[model samples]
Target: MNSIRFTKWLFSTLLFISVAVSSCQKDDNVKSMDSNKSIAAADSASTMGVINTPGNFLAGKGTLKITIEDSTYTFDAATDSVAFINVHSGDSKYFGITAINKAHTMSFGISSVGFAATNVNSKVAGSQFLFKLDEKNPVVQYTLTKYGGKDDSGKISIEKYNNDNLIAKGTFFTFLAKDDKVNSPFYRVEGSFELQLK
Candidate 1:
């Protein structure tokens, strides 16, 4: 009778210890999994925060503003018409941004070739900038051509590009000539634009 009692007690004690250990291990594993999931969530949130900033044009309507010499021209989605063009032809790609004021008399345009979505935050060379103060009058047109000498050339830098949303934001600076003469007067033009691709 004494030997049987001792054997039963030993078996019960061993079973209790085994069960306790197994439960502890399971708890540890669950804690580790939870920690990893939290870390991944934090990383994802930070990445999105960096990509989507405040006042992002891709989130809504677009805007365009340019300064020509002493005059500043502004176009907004609320009152003006802003548009973007993306074209692929052969081995090259073309990107353009155009804006017209509500009055329909003033317009601004910039065009570049060989720039793609991968060119974000990088300067795109050989861009042409055009500003027309009077659409019906040819004399009021100003243009910056790629062949217009070093001082007359310009660059366009795209700050953000969203291929999924078909939106882009960029800035440009150029020296536009009123005429093709070497001694002709030129206006310093600088501006920024945000538009959805059409």
Candidate 2:
């Protein structure tokens, strides 16, 4: 009889412990669900200004043709060749540029040109231009033109970029007369062109 009574007490104790553990597990699940909801709500509230939507003009992919006036001076105190221009077109802009022939100019007495000094690894702060949308290393072509009895050539390139909060960025190339043919005492004639979107 004593043995049977002891068996019944053991069974009752195990049943009570199981019921308590199940109640605690249900409470933990409820707390986890509440935490997830709060995080989602905070994320939605953070991106409220300047373009929260993902499919705006700065979201989709498109091409724009921007034209900008050259704004630099040469040794003769005259407006130098248009190197890089920033044309702000809502969808497009015009870069007031001329084309140059690279093969012919290099064949002549002109010196070879190179890119400007800028950090390409990081994005420019608060910029509105996409310089290398299609490719960072742009392939450019030039065509020669006659200006003021001087045999001059123009260089040009086109670039593309994805949609972002800021405008696009790009770089252009120009090879000026580097020899005594320029008739200027200062033999330093080097410049570059740039395009930006705003």
Best model per TM-score: 1
lDDT of 1: 0.51
User: How does each model score on lDDT?
Assistant: 0.51, 0.24
Summarize candidate 1's per-residue lDDT along 11-47 as a digit string, tens digits.
Answer: 3332332222122222213334455334434554324
**Would you list the clashing residue pairs of candidate 1?**
none
Give the total clashing residue pairs for model 1. 0
Report lDDT (Cα) of residue 97, candidate 2.
24
Ten-residue stretch with the least lDDT total in model 2: 74-83
Output the lDDT of residue 144, model 1: 59
Candidate 1's C-alpha runs over 4 A off are 1-60, 118-139, 145-148, 163-166, 196-198
